[model samples]
Target: MVDVQGTVTDGFEPVRDAFAENFARRGERGAAVALYRDGRKVVDLWAGTKDADAPGDGPSAPWERGTAQIVRSATKGVAAAVPLLLHQRGLVDLDAPVGTYWPEFKAAGKERVLVRHLLAHRAGLPALDTPLTPAEAVDGVSGPRALAAQAPAWEPGTDHGYHAQTYSWLIGELVERITGRSAGRWIAEEIAGPLGLDLWIGLPESERHRPGRISDVEPPADPAAPGLRMRPRKAVTDAYDDPASLTRRAFAAISPAADENAPAWRAAELPASAGIATAEGLARFYASLIGDVDGHRRLFAPATLTLARTEESAGPDRVLIVNTRFGLGYMLHGPASPLLGPGSFGHPGRGGSLAFADPESGISFGYVTNGMQKNVTADPRAQALVRGVARALAG
Candidate 1:
């Protein structure tokens, strides 16, 4: 068995057991899970190897308490706060047209796209006609420029779809235009730094050789792992398989996929995808969103917190083809997303990373894994840990 490490308050032993079961029965390789309740750490655990750089049946490096990894689309939740924070400070108007901030955005049909529309995934600019090459995608200017030139797939705010790769440029460009700084730098200085968080929007060069330098994990070796597997959905599979489908096109907006472990990709701030964080850092971030952290002030005021969980858009997502719920950039608890509770809000990475906060329960949770799986929103490994939290709360 892969030995689990870290501590949990007395009531959280169920979470430790769940973390162990993930490796023993759920096909979890290298993974970590953490949670904060009422602003204090309640669960922190890690298990298995940091196989991001290691490969094959070779001896593996042990996963450490401070290890971090790219959290894929989960980055959206972290990046979402940037614009909202700006709005909180009266620097950006949520209802105003995005063109009000970035004039060139008005050149295309996007003139009608409002700030809230972008947050709600209703800007209707999911798939790109001309996708960016991996190099161009991370070049900073190329992404936002490409998105600015494209016409919307639907009328802005009339419908909703997961922006997928386009979201990086959409949110990142707005941050740059507003702060005159890169999204990564802004997040580091404003959000992560103040909170003393081990989170990074774009991983830095100096951090590469640091004690917990992150790398990409290998894909699942067994799709039919006994503990959990995908519920067969022909429609979901068909949509993704078809090149002409919006689902496929939206995900393909980055064209040739970038190697996530590549330093270049890590150094460039793709706010939608390139976030790197340890389990605790991510959970602590969510804790501060819903309440104070260790007596420190929270990032979201009550009004802002309400804005984050308010239903901005909910229904069949045009790109995902699955019924989804969104509040600004945060994904709400729903059928497709099994977060903590009805009041929960956060985003999940494409494969195994997940994080969220439930103000009603005073719970902020995060889980990250090197065991990339076919599961998207509610990875079984993550849900297991979440259920453990529920058990702890019950007692």
Candidate 2:
């Protein structure tokens, strides 16, 4: 195992093995994992090189360091949290019609859609029917405005489908309409700011140098490669492998740009997919749900937290093609869930980054890696760390 350094108040040493195995698998690239319990920082560790160009930093390079890479869809969970928090304060209503807040959304038979449907990934605007470039996707006003005009793929709440890339803009517009501030600013001023979390819905240019430079993983040369064909049509072909296609458009920070680490990309703030955060900040955010950090509580009420962990949709997600279940704003432990445990509720980004909370056990975990893996969830490397954390927590 690559050298690791961190404290485990509960004395779970296996957590070290989790990091070791993944680093070994990645040839010693840089990554970080953090855990919080009862609102206190319990596990904060880092290792390897942050960038491939400047390797050989050794184990002492600083586990507590590194910038947020695009956590992909993990941003959805963070993005979902904004509306939920607002709902709690009567600033927004979960059961009320989404168009009630964002009138423009009513244009496409979305008048009956509720806020919960959007959070649950059932709003049905998965891929924008209108093709947009990376620049158009994140050019501030254009992305959300275009989404507001798009039509739903399925009936609002009839079936669940992962919104894929469109979720943030769809929900972001509602957030802006309701709070009068873009989701990014609101998250920064309300959630990240108060909690002292380094997470960002939109990244700022000043911190660009801090982020670990993410190199997109090259897809399998042969479609027959193991794991390459898992869901080749949807996950591979439709999402990442095409040149100048939707997947490329999806990655470009310009046309509905969801580029995980760009400055203009970070500034747009599509909570569903573009969240940037370090493992430390992510863990602390989750820890706040079960326990408060320095007297700060930035999530649902403890009871509401309990409510969120309860499964909402647990079957074939029309979009993801897996039996994914969702909690209020998090992913519930289900057959398709990576961590595969009852108490956990969180989401994994498209390329392997993840963050979640296990409220029943008062455990919060975060994993961030620069190396992008093709698998969306149940990633062996990420699961190893989670399993280690679980073993540590239980011990």
- My TM-score estimates for the predictions, one after another, are 0.95, 0.85
lDDT (tens digit, per residue) of candidate 2 on 244-270 = 443343333234333344466656676
TM-score for candidate 2 = 0.85
Query: All models: lDDT?
Result: 0.86, 0.69
User: Model 1 shows how many backbone clashes?
Assistant: 0
lDDT of 1: 0.86
Instruction: Give the CA lDDT, 0 to 100, for residue 22 in model 1.
Output: 91
**Model 1: per-residue lDDT, tens digit, 1-395?**
77788998999898998899998888887988999999999888887888754757687788887889889889999999999999999999999999998999996788889999999999999888988898998888888888888899999999999988889999999988999988789989988988988899888778877754674666422221222223347667777778898888898887677777777877778888889999999999999998888778889989999999999999888887778899988999987888879999999987789999999999999899888887657788888888988888898
Candidate 2 residue spans exceeding 4 A from truth: 26-28, 52-66, 209-261
